[model samples]
Target: MVQSIVEELEPLFNPKSVAVVGATTNWNKWGYSTFTSALNGFRGPVYPINNKESEILGHKAFARVTDIPDAVDLAIIVIPSTGVAAVMEDCVAKGVKAAVIISAGFAEIGKEGKRLQDEVLSIARKGNIRFIGPNCMGFWSASSDLRGFMFPLPVKDGPLAFVSQGGNVGGAVVTSGFMRGVGFHRYVSCGCAADIQIEDYIEYFGEDPEVKVILAYIEGLVDGRRFLDKVKKVTPTKPVIVLKPGKTDAAAKAITSHSGALAGSDEAYEAAFKSIGVTRVESPEELLDVAIGFLTQPLPEGRNVAILTPGGSYGILCAEACATEGLEVVKLPDRVIAALDKVFPPRWSHGNPIDPAGDRNLLTYLTAPGKLLKVDEIDSLIFMGFSGFSIYTSLFVSRESGEGAPWISSREAFREVAKEFTRAVSLKDTVKIGQTILPIVSGMASRMGIYHEEDVSELTEIIAAAIVSGRLRVPFLVSAFLPPGSEALAEMGVKTPPTANEASAHFLVAMAEQWVASYKKPVLTTTFFTVDQPRLEGTHYAYPSGRHAARVLIKMVEYKEYLDVSQK
Candidate 1:
């Protein structure tokens, strides 16, 4: 009821019982989708409210909210605009705790609509009832088994919390996120946000333990200062990534009409977001890419970077990205050079990049980046060509084909090949270079370890074990590594990408930024940034371009350093 911050929104998110006020079975209407959405995976009871119908969606229908025999924790209103106020009266009488009004024709339409929205809001406050929208898609949470969106969200679960003012944009976010395997902990399309504003959700999710990162897609905010204040308190503890797209005058006007919100001075929002350490993204893709990077990778320790690329031009492009992000491309220290010298091919670009002489398979590609992580001189790393090796690995797998060898006989073996490669390519996932992944890495600890073989996340490590234990596959890897990757892979096999993936290498830079952030240092760092395949091992928020992503990372790192110094 107009609380400064709506504390414990669990009832709204994880309700014991839910009622669809405008419940209907009309296949084409919003009411149908909204009502049925709850039943898909919601853990509790659902009641459908319809004045005339005896039954809706197979649930015993009620003529009014007051008619329900038990208390209702949440109500979803999708009735026609003219009748919503009466329904609210019923909801208040029935002692509803929260409501999500999916009705339109509100303030954005004209004066009359604003009056109707205001009347309903006043009643809601008087009853001490909190609500989400007068014009919105509602909410969805995987952990609570709730679905209150425009439609059923994919049953995916992860650590990002997304809040959006635009229902369409938020819908796309959840849909795209599901396809990309980027799971969401919560999604609130804070439509109209008549009773509960953006600030409330910002601070709520900022502290929500289930959320590692917060992604907000705002066309506009109802109260900018409230949001800024809440964000300042929250951003320091959890990363807040926002996509505020109402920069142009035309778009600003649309934002106002869409959510009845003033897309206030774009400059002010920009400055506020930056000042509070919020990661401001410009597109949906960036929102998802950065989210995934933050979720999957470990943070870097400082601004010092180690870049490994397969091509010279790609390496140069990455260097430009580094400069754009204010990341220093530190030269290879002597120890790093010596460590890499032992493994690099003839005429390799033997410095910071550790570029192979040419294109290579997963093992060789990973070996250089893996070696670079050992140097204390560098604090972060980026890999650009590792995905190409996914294609290269198949060549070795098919050398024996479906009819030939033992390891190549089953589909599981084929997939195992990729998993083996992923383990090495994803060295960042296996362990924190400076942090302990297991109890100990020393020789003494290895002997004491009960599950030493399972400790490693690499196939190369597994193969090494196989060799040591005398159960080896001789021709596949031995002769496979003798020739250089390009000739060896091509001489053996290197198929063109099944068809190109339009995704660029830019998200890798974003992942790098998020990766280094795991250390909570006042600098940006990453261990993998090499280009290719739309996937980031498994999930990422979006990838704008190396240059754009680097610029965003630069902003975050700068703010971090500023915060650290100011506090000191």
Candidate 2:
């Protein structure tokens, strides 16, 4: 039964033809925004209905829904709340099956408004029509190019699915998501849920093949038991993330008045969420963080983490967060420490966090990552670094350096000397010795994309490590530390500028940890502090130099998740 409903809802987004019952020419009105968004986003035929206007946005406007010349699969109602019933009736007369009501001032207003909402539902029921909302923002379906709301923003098509109780909230989620690399398959804004409730959308997305992560910005749940049942069926197959507002009594009262909702007890909702395996996040940012993590990384088998940082402070913070989140920060075995000692200087911290203190040059930056990744005690690694020397070094060596140079030769010499020393020592477990050095060597070779004398040696070490680590199965999260008053850092380069709050190094770490907890995957983030001037329009926003580390981390995790899941 649930599967059939999911299948049925697919067409609501992928309709062949749509009718805009209250379409208008004024750009400020909801009718105009809905019509324009549909024309811009939907690939299907659109009919605009406006009694007073002959045409809107160059499309011929009909006087009523029944006057449309072609068959209409979807009807968008942008009229006043009091007029929704009549518009819905006209839709039924025109043989429209689905309706999206983008009007406000319905049940959310008061009892008088509730009476009008009840009438609208009655009319839709009598006509056997399924409607989305009476006080909502509408929805968007990337697959179908169906955007039925007033948000005049652009979005990409991907696996994330979002559902929100407020139209503005949905718009914010979509906007923020697009700014990041994450995209969406569908978005739903079911205000008041008078006709179709939140559970309906959850059930629909739960069975959707295109949607891997389901996110909800929820204020209240109408039917707790049914919602939990749906979540139980969905979560094992896909991740369900919820960002519920109304935590305080004041907030709950505000929510109830705003949406005409019965904001339930905050504790009760929290308990229900935990009982159903639904991951609860605190803010909109956390919701997106977890959604991105689930969409990008594989779930770790256990809560044991291997922390890696370019500095000691970040390592300590990572350790604290891991413990607080009920995850064990395992100690690196002596053998692993001994192997690290071969590459790092005497002052390096060879403990679990693996902090190579002092200025980390490009060579150390690149080499340390692979070493931490190869360790057996560490199931996963989190790389934390700051701007200035470390970010420049890592990016330069890993991305910009066209030819393998000084460090490449040094790595080869070290490997050959280590191999001879192991043989001289008659170490039976030279397998571990070879395993530790190989990945570092090969990673450098791969980065250079050429086979030189150094390349052969480095590749050899990496291959040996791969064999020992069972193909080096490790998930890594990267973070970049930023200095205080770092708002100027956002304008340093030709990319998306980071917000002041987003540029904070501590916020980045918190965001990554929240991602791990919410989605059970490793996350990477970076920060920067700069004094560069802001770019004007037509010029791209300048993202700080260190921010690229976070971007790379996000991309790597996403690719890994795609390969793992797709192979399965």
Candidate 3:
């Protein structure tokens, strides 16, 4: 009987019972890793198929998959390449619906390997069984709690569905994305494409309701025409991002051996991707940046953007970047400039890239973006500068008696902190404290009781949820100098002074996420300082540079145009 794509792939993700065809007791072996990892809270029964051992990892062992008493929905084959064909035959006899072959030494090795891979594929096909790989790491499904991968990943339930031709690369993206607050609904390591190819997974993810955006790392294509046909149907409704690395001949040669995939004409692939509205990124960083932009921000109505920077240089830099990326650095209308004048000082740039010229007021930083976005000419806004909350919060105030000791008496710590915050930061003309800067201020709002230290993470989520839930109609990308991850910030010791830039990123995400949700726009951010580790969490990420933000916006613009055209 013919099966739908979901029907064909469902067991691969939500299998009721699984058999580890090469279960082993050796810690170094792939079979051991696969079976042991699957036992970590997999939703259903996991049986170990091994002849020598009575049991493996506390489960009864079966000599062959067919010997298992229960009907197997999925079979995980991690035996030698020479033994994979036999394992497939046993899986076929057992009426297994899907299999994930994690063993190596397949087509990537050479002609003999290719012949073996073909033989295994033929057996699986004849038995109406679909499989993941002849040489793969394995797959992970968040919905089913299926952990079939060899490597361990701190999987979080999210909207992204990532498929990669390279296992290590896929693992890296998944790991990096997790550190940066991106999560995955499903992650598939497509090894050698012996049977189940990358395009097949794309079509399945496209149909899966859990997925919002699809990301792919392609070394080469198995069938270019089939990929195009399948991807074309998925792109109009959802975004399909691909990072193809075979642009140069040297890279193409490396790719050929990497996954045994044919590195087709790079130019032809580019044209096809463009025609089908697939967002092609240059690197893994770009891939994640574009993915975050899509998930967190709304598409801009047009290419016109208004930039608000804390310094003249960032304004100039961002303006140039936006123009170079084919986005219009829109000229501020007289009314818009007039509106900004009320918020910024006399030295403000007063032009398109509105430079506050070292305006240290929290009110000004919070108010600037809304002013520019209100203009009809501006479809998007880029706030570039010292926009982190650490600058204005009392967290940096000395808690100990030392060189940077607290200014107030110990009896009145909270009150003194609140008083000191008001004094250091200019809250002048702040008509309504709660409406103006409730949660983004990142301190205890003693008067309004709107913010507290304990609620920092929750408030941050509120900000992100606001942006993600369509708070802004146009995209809003912010930049910071040194935005640390949430863990890094939380682990920060009682220091003399906080990393102002890092704190800026911490608060920038909160403000941006909140503002985006309020306005129903996308708020992407850039960072200047190096965060040697991944620390930021939730939907907010501090991209390495402003150019990264620009690239994200441009890609979003391109996707928006494609969607618009497709709808028409």
Give per-residue CA lDDT, model 2, range 34-59, as digits (tens). Answer: 88888886778999999999988888
lDDT order, best first, reads: 3, 1, 2
How do the residues 1-568 of candidate 3 rate in per-residue lDDT, one tens digit apiece?
8788998888889998888888889888878888887876787999999989988866789888888888999998888899999889988888999999999999998899999999999999988888987678988999888889885677777899999988888888888788777789999998897887789999999999989999999888778899989999999878999999888999989987888888889999989999999999998878877998898788888898877666677678887888899999887899888877765678888798777777666545565666666567888877664334234433333223231222223335534444443342343322232232343334332222323342333343344444344432111211111132322222223222345344444555567767665565655555554453235554555565567778999999999999998889
> How well does candidate 2 score on lDDT at residue 410?
44
lDDT of each: 0.65, 0.64, 0.73
Per-residue lDDT, model 1, residue 77, is 88
Ranking 1 against 3 by lDDT, winner = 3
- Look at candidate 2 and give me any clashing residue pairs: 438-461, 438-462, 439-462, 442-458, 478-524, 478-525, 479-525, 480-526, 493-542
Per-candidate count of clashing residue pairs (backbone under 3 Å): 19, 9, 19
Model 2 clash tally, residue pairs: 9
Candidate 1: minimum summed lDDT over ten consecutive residues — where?
A: 496-505
Model 3 segments more than 4 A misplaced: 386-390, 394-508, 532-538
In candidate 2, which residue ranges exceed 4 Å CA deviation? 1-3, 369-376, 386-525, 528-568
Query: 96-211, model 1: which lDDT tens digit per residue?
Result: 98888888888878788999999999988777788888888878877668788656666477788888988888888878777666778888888888887777887878767888
Of the two candidates 1 and 2, the one with more favorable TM-score, higher being better, is 1
RMSD of each: 9.4, 11.2, 8.0
